[model samples]
Target: MMENKPDEPVDHLSQLPVLRLNLHELAREQRTEQGQLALRDLTRLLSALVAGHAAVQTGQVDWRVRGYTHAQPGGDVQPMIELKVSAVLPLLCQRCLQPALQRVQDKVLFRLVEQEPGLTQEELEAEDEALCVRVAVDIQAMVEDQMLLALPLVPMHEVCPQPIVVAGLEAQPIDLPARASPFAALASLKKGK
Candidate 1:
């Protein structure tokens, strides 16, 4: 049996777990934050997101996200969250079909819209990064979405492990026994009749 120490005390804050946050509330309060997270926690979420992707390797990379939520400029009262995500992941090179390291870095600034907008041209063209935060936001999911979007359209090694070679079919002629044409048979039957 070991003796209990009275002098030392545990610091719980440092060991506290990170939880999903309400982006709207954070924005309302106007705060700046930063944190580091492991890929292990997001295995299932990422598996579904990257199912068809060649580089579906998971649990090797770590993510770092930094952001600040504040009122948008130009006298806009609405809040905007600007976030940056950085990570390095192992991806399959399309050229060689082998594993290669890929660096993913993305930044997004979103102006939180309270109500879902009706069908409009601006909503159609809102690809520049704007999201409506009506409920608590899952930071992990948000970062994963950014990572998935940042994946290269065509992932390839700058210098492939092996060179790709394409072979063309060579033209060749096949020999076959000659057969009477249908018209010849028809004429023969007509003559026989």
Candidate 2:
């Protein structure tokens, strides 16, 4: 039998689950300036997200997010988080098999869902049809996902201007005829005879 102890408090915050912020709420909670969140506060929130393993890596991202909320035709509230990201990311070059710097400038649009319970399967399915937000907007995650998606699968030079030669393998020489075929000599002999 498992005994519940009051002293051993469970981390309810962890269990509280991730909530998607209503876009409208996010818009309303904007920082003093327009189109930007406080860098310090945003960094703190980003750190939490990074710690939770929700984002890929900290040092690689540089971007901003502009969020807004609006009511849909059916009266469902939705948050739209728009991200503008630009960064120089290191990726493996397919041709050279070496690490290369890739400049990325891209945008991503994500929809936020409300956190609610007691909805039936049909209702949940309907909500899913709508933009569902599994986790609150973490700027880092948004930027990282967008940048990763924008990057090319194989990075290489378009024209491959440089000449490449593999160390171990050398070019094979083409074979050519050393002398004329016997048929040609026979034809000349027949003409003379």
Candidate 3:
């Protein structure tokens, strides 16, 4: 961490500005933007992190976004945005219940669309791991959303620092009587006849 004197002026260049990008304009002009953000500025993501963990101790985020259009076979141009983000997040390990540092990375290609008949664009995000968006885009919120999704379902270290024992009943193998085959019932009926 860089320390500044009380009298020193702060440099704001490293700080990212809030952006609400117009997806349509971006695709038409094929624009690209890249910058770094303070994790403290990302309220939602910051709240998700484990408090007082060294992994996310620095509190930083890196992001890049590019927009372009693709001409479909029918001469319809489709707006698209390619987004990439990466960050080291602190999370509670499910295995040992300890603070685990997890690197979350996400590269997504979003097909921008207008309103669909019945489907919500947010709901379409989970389809086949692809992303879709409509209207203007809030870059900050988008980054948070993608980052959250990229987080591991169960965060854990490959090898825990130490083993942890919990009080629980040991699982024992169960044996059950096998059920007769469907044909056995038919055989029984025929024999009775």
Candidate 4:
């Protein structure tokens, strides 16, 4: 059974391994010209982590992150900030299309890089360079990506609880008592005459 634990606070980035991120804090950071978005906004981040990958199964995942900070040469100045996160998430049943409610846990380590707009588009797209970029360390997006990556592609159990059964019309047998036809009765009367 999947346990519903209380949401813990996330003052630092390291705490995300427990349960993604503090959802409330992530939501606060996502406000834009558009009003508050749905929880799906955060899920999009999760999708990025799983995109082009097979579905995940339900279970708990343990993740650890190190070297989250960027540093400049010969100095302690780091322009880019990085964060690592990990967790486990429950996957829905693919067959019955029901919530399998199974929890699969895994450990993932990913980095988030801060993009500098000053760099030209070509420089940003250069090969052998980091591809993932964010305006700021959007904790919500990071947490979402982690959660999505944990979902299973085919999330059904070994045996489906409910199986479809087809009922044929012939399966229902109907019985009726035999009765003499009215024409037979008329023929008998003519013969007696």
lDDT of each: 0.65, 0.53, 0.77, 0.43
| lDDT per residue (tens digit) for residues 51-107 in model 1 | 444344344334443334554578667666777777666667778877776787877
Q: 56-169 in candidate 3: lDDT tens per residue?
A: 547677899888887889899878788899988888888998888888888888777665434667756643233445557788888888887788889998788887766784
Model 4 TM-score on a 0 to 1 scale: 0.34
Report the C-alpha displacement of residue 68, candidate 1, in angstroms. 5.7
Backbone clashes in model 1, listed as residue pairs: none
Q: Model 4: per-residue lDDT, tens digit, 1-193?
A: 9554579543434434332332222323432111121232343433433332233322223333223334458875332222334443334566765444455444443323344334778756643234244333444554455556655667776676787445565555688789999999999999999
Highest lDDT: give the candidate number.
3
- By TM-score: ranked, best first: 3, 1, 2, 4
Clashes of each: 0, 3, 0, 21
Candidate 3 Cα misplacement greater than 4 A, ranges: 1-16, 120-136, 167-193
The candidate, 1 or 2, that scores higher on lDDT is: 1
User: Over the full model, what C-alpha lDDT does candidate 3 score relative to the true structure?
Assistant: 0.77
**Per-residue error at 107 for model 3, in Å?**
1.9
User: Model 2, range 130-192, lDDT digits (tens) per residue?
Assistant: 345554454444444566567776776544445667887759966877998899999999999
Question: Model 3 misses residue 155 by how many Å?
Answer: 0.4
Question: Of 2 and 3, which scores higher on lDDT?
Answer: 3
Stretches off by above 4 angstroms in model 4 are: 1-65, 68-91, 111-135, 163-193
The all-Cα superposition gives candidate 3 an RMSD in Å to the true structure of: 6.7
